[model samples]
Target: MNNTNTVPLVAILRGVLPQDVLAHIEVLIAAGFTTVEIPLNSPDWQTSIAMAIARFGDRIQIGAGTVTSANDVAILSQMKCSFILTPNTDPAVIKAAREAGMQTCIGCHTASEAFVAIQHGANALKIFPAGELGSGYIRALKAVLPKHIPLYAVGGITPANLAEYLRAGCVGAGLGGDLYRAGQSPEQTANQARAFKQAWDACQKR
Candidate 1:
C-alpha cells in the first residue's frame, strides 16, 4: 500500500458513475490526493474502478470500498486493484485479499475487532462512524494498537473536523459525502478536494 503520510486524506467516491469517475479522479490527483476508493455499491462500480486503474493507476492508488465477501476478492484482484476497504472486519475476507496481494483496510470499532483484523493481516484499520465515536475513541484505541498500524477514521468526516481526528492519532481519514456526491460536477469535486487537502496541510503545520 502507498504511504498515507504523504497525502493523508482518502477520497471516497460513492455512487460515482463510470463516465464521470475519471474526471473526479483527475481533479483529486491535481488537488494532491493520491489515494481514492469507489465503493462497490456504486453503479457499474467495477467498470469505474477498471477505468480508474487504466488511466490514473500509475499516478495514484485506486481501490474499492464496502467490500464484504471474499467472492469479490478474486474479481478485484483480476483487475489489479491496489487495495480493498471493508466496512466491517471479516477474517476470511482479510485473508483472501492479502493472499491475492491486495492491501486490506478493515473497519473495526472496538479493541477486540481491531486485534482480530490485525491478526488477519489487515494493512490498516478504519474506524467507521468515526464522527459518532469521536476522536476520543481513536485516542484511546491508539494507545493499545501496534505503533506501526495505521488508523483511518471514516464516516461523517469533513475538512473542518478532519484535523481533529488526525490529532487524535489517525494516520488519515476516509472522505465520503464531504468529498463527492453522485452527480456533483468535476469542478465541484476539485474545490472539495482542495479544501480537504488544505485542511490536512494546515494540520501538519500544528
Candidate 2:
C-alpha cells in the first residue's frame, strides 16, 4: 500500500493470539512479507492488532480485515492501523477510511463490484475466491478495468498454488487458513510462514 509501486502481499492472521501475533510478525518479515491483516471475526483481534502495532508499526503495514461498518474503520484507526480491508465493498466504510487517510483493499467478486470499489477510492482490489475464478480470469477482468489498478488474489491462495497464481498476473496474494491455522504454536506459525515465503520466492525466480 506504499508509493513504491511494490505489490501488496498481505499475511492474513485469522487465528493468531494476542501473545503469539508478534512471533508471527517476525516470521512474516523473515518470510519476505511486510503487510499484515487481522480479521475482526477473530477472537480478541483488537488486542492482537494493538499489540502488533506497538511492536511492528515502523516496519510493517498493519491492517484490519473483514471491516463492514464505518465504526470498525474508526476503531481500527484508533488502534493506529495503517490500512483497512473488507471482505466486501461498502461505500460508507470506504468513504470513512478514505477520509481518515488510510489505505484500503476492498474485496470484490464481479466486474460491477470491482468497479464500484475503484469508484469508492480503494487503494487496491482483492479478488475474493480467486481460486474459483482461476488465475486466467484476471486477464479477462483486466481487459475491462483500469490497467494501473493492482489486483490481489485472496481465498484459496496457498503455498501449493501460489506460483500458478502469481505467474498468471496477480500482483500479490492473501493467505487465510493456509497461513495461520487455528491454535497453532509459534513454531508452527513460523514453519508455515517459511513455506509460503519459499513458494513466493520461487515465483520471483521465474
Candidate 3:
C-alpha cells in the first residue's frame, strides 16, 4: 500500500499490549517499517490500533490482523484503519474489507485458497506457515498465480531465510516473533527491525 516497487515488510504484533504498543511501533517506524498489524486476539487490540492511528497514522500504516468477521471490518473502517488481515481466506471478510476501503491480505495455504482469495478481491496473499511450505511451495504456486498478485510469506519468517522466499518470487513477508516478542524492549525490537530491513535491502540488490 506504500506504492513502492520494493516488497513491503509487515510487522506482526501478535501479543503486544496497548500501553506498550505505541512505543514498540515507534521503534519499528524508526527502523523503516511502515506497515504494522496488531492481531485482534491481543488484549484490547482495538485500543492499540486506535492509539497507533491517532498518534502516527500519517507516518505509518496501521491495521488489524486475525480479523474474521464483517463486523470486525466495519469496526476497523470506523476506526479509520488502513488494512485488514485474516488468517483464513473468507470471501465475505475480504469483500467487507474491500467495501470498507481497506486493503485486504487474506491467508491461504493451498493453490485453491489462493485463487479463491484473489477472486474475492484480496490485495495480497499471505502464505501462512511458510516455513513448513518452503520456497518450493511458493514456486509451484507462482506458476499458476497471476504475476500481479503479491505473495507475502508469513509465519516462521526470519532475516536468514527471507531472501530465499524473495528469490522464490514472494513479494514480501509478515514478521512476527522473530521481529518482536511480547515482552521484548523497544530497543531490542528496533535492533531486530533493522536486521530485517538490511536483509530485505540485500535481497533487493540481487
Candidate 4:
C-alpha cells in the first residue's frame, strides 16, 4: 500500500501475457495506479509477476491474485511479492501469506467470512461479486467490521459505478475485465486506466 489518501485501485490483469504485461503496467502506473495483480490462472503468470516486480516493484505494489495454496505462497514469497489476493478466505493460506511477510486481502461475502479472515490476519477484505451484491451489502458489512478494516469491492466494478461502492464505505476496488481484457492493446489499457483514476479522484472529492 502506498499509504496516501489516493484510493488504492488494484489493476487485476487476469489474462495478461508475460511479453505484453510490462507495457500494460507501464500505462497503468502512468495513470496513477500503484497496485497490480496477475492472477495465477493466467498464462505464464509466475513469469509475468516476476517481470513486473523486477521492473516496477520499487515504484508500485505487485503481487499474485486468485491464490489458493500455501505452496503457491512459498513460490511468491521467494519472489518477494508485496501482497496476495485470494478469491476466498482460507485460514491456512492467510497464515502462510502473513508468515511470508506479504499483505493479504482475502475475499469474503458475509460477516462471518469477513470476521474469520480478520482473525486469521488478513490486512484487508475484498467483497467479491461486489456489483452483484451491491453497495448496500457493503454498507451493512462496514457497519459491523472494525473501523480500520479497509473494504475493497471486486468483480464487475467500473468507472461508472465505483463511486456507489465508495460512498457505501468501500476504500477501493479490484478492477478486472472492465479495467483490462485479454488481447487489448496498450493504448486501450491506457484509456481505461486513466478513466478509472479520474473516477477515483472524483469520488474522493465528494
Candidate 5:
C-alpha cells in the first residue's frame, strides 16, 4: 500500500515474539527492507506492532497480516499502520480499511477474485500460495489484470525463485520463513534479508 512498486519486498515476521520483534526489525532495516508485517495470529502481535511503530515508525512501514475482520482494520487504522494484508479477498474488510484511509493488499487465487478485489479498492493483489501456482500462473493472471495493478507473490517465496515470479510479472513479494525464523539470531536473519535484497536488486538490474 505504500507504493510498493518502488520497494517491493515485505518482510513477514509471523512468529516473532514482541520482546525480540524490535531487534529482528532492526536487522531487516539494516538489510534495506522498508516494509514489515506481523501476522495477527502471532502471540501478542498487536504489542509487537505497536512496539515496532513506536520505535521505528519513521524508518519503516509496519503492517498487520492475516487480517479477517473490519474490526481488525479499525484497530490498524487507529495504530496508523501502513497497510493491511489478507490471505483471502474480503470486500467488507477491504472497504473498511480503505474507508479508514489505509492501504490494502487483498489475496486472490483466480482471475475472478482478482477482479473483485480491485473493484473493492484494494491497493494491490497478493497471489497467495504462489509457490504452488508458480510463475506461469501469475503470467496467466497478468494477461487479464490491469497493467497498473501491483501483484505480489507470497508463500513459499525464496531468493532463488523470486526472479521467476518477477519475470512472470509480480511487482513484489512477501517473504516469510525464508527471511526470518522465530528463534534465529538477528545476525542470521539479517544475512538472509541481505541475500534477498541482493537478489531483488539483481533482478531489477536485468
Candidate 6:
C-alpha cells in the first residue's frame, strides 16, 4: 500500500514466471523498488505472491493488482498483502479493503471517476492506460485533482519516459511489459528489473 507521503515506482509483474519472481524482486529491492505489485492474472499468481511475501515481506511492500472483487481483497489481505490495486473503482471492494487494513489504489480515467474513488477512500489513484493519455493527460488530471491524492501512472510506464510522467505530476509509476516482457529468461528479467529501478532513481534525481 502507498501513501501520499511516500512516492513509489510500483512494478507490475503481469506475466512474470514463478521461477523469476524471487530473482526479479531481489534485483528490484536492491535497485530501490521497495514496492511491487503482482497481478493475479499471472500463472500461479497466488503462489508467486505467497513466495514474495514469505521472502521479502519484511522489507518490501508486496501487493496484488487487477483486483475487481471483494473476495480477492479478502484473500489477498489474508495472505498478508501490503497493498492492493484495482483496474476500476468498486466502492464495496474499497470499503472491504479498508476494513482489512490494506492500502487501495484504484484505476480511474476521468476527474469525476478519480474524485469518486477518492471519496470512497482510495489511498492512491492509478491512471490506467496511461500511455494512451500520455503525460499531457496526466498534467490535465493533476491540474484538477486534490494535491493530497497520490497519482501513479501505470499500463505503459518505462525507463525512456519515466521522467516525463513524473514531470507531469505523477509522484509514482508502475510498469508491466517494459520490465517483464514475455519469453525472457530469469536472468534477463532480473537485469531488466534492475534497469527499471535505475530509471526510477534517475527520475528522482531530476
Candidates 2 and 4 compared: the better one by lDDT is 4
Model 3, range 75-190, lDDT digits (tens) per residue? 99999999888899999999899888899989999999999999989999999989989999999998899999989999999999999999999888999989988888999999
Predicted candidate 1 versus true structure: per-residue lDDT over 33-91, tens digit per residue:
99989999999998999999999998888989999999998899999998999999899
Q: Which pairs of residues clash in candidate 1, taking residues 3 or more apart in a chain or in different chains?
A: none
lDDT of each: 0.92, 0.85, 0.91, 0.93, 0.92, 0.85
CA RMSD of all predictions: 1.1, 1.6, 1.2, 1.1, 1.2, 1.9
| Candidate 6 backbone collisions, by pair | 1-83
* Top-down lDDT ranking: 4, 1, 5, 3, 6, 2
Q: Name model 1 segments beyond 4 Å from true.
A: 4-6
- State how far residue 64 of model 2 sits from its true place (Å): 0.8
Number of the candidate with higher lDDT, 1 or 3: 1
On the 0 to 100 scale, the lDDT of residue 25 in model 3 is 92
After TM-score superposition, the amount by which residue 20's alpha carbon in candidate 2 deviates from its true location, in angstroms, is 2.1
lDDT per residue (tens digit) for residues 1-206 in model 6: 55443438787877766787898888777666778889988888899999999999988789998999999998998899998999998898899999999999989998888999999999999998898899999999999989998898998888888888899998788878887765566576667767877777777676
Error of 4 at 98 (Å): 0.8
Q: Please list the residue runs of candidate 3 whose C-alpha ends up more than 4 Å from where it truly belongs after superposition.
A: 5-7
| Clashes per candidate (backbone, < 3 Å) | 0, 0, 0, 0, 0, 1
Q: If scored against the real structure, what TM-score would every candidate get?
A: 0.97, 0.93, 0.97, 0.97, 0.97, 0.92
Better of 3 and 6 by TM-score: 3
Error of 4 at 81 (Å): 0.6
Instruction: Give candidate 5's error at residue 77 in angstroms.
Output: 0.8
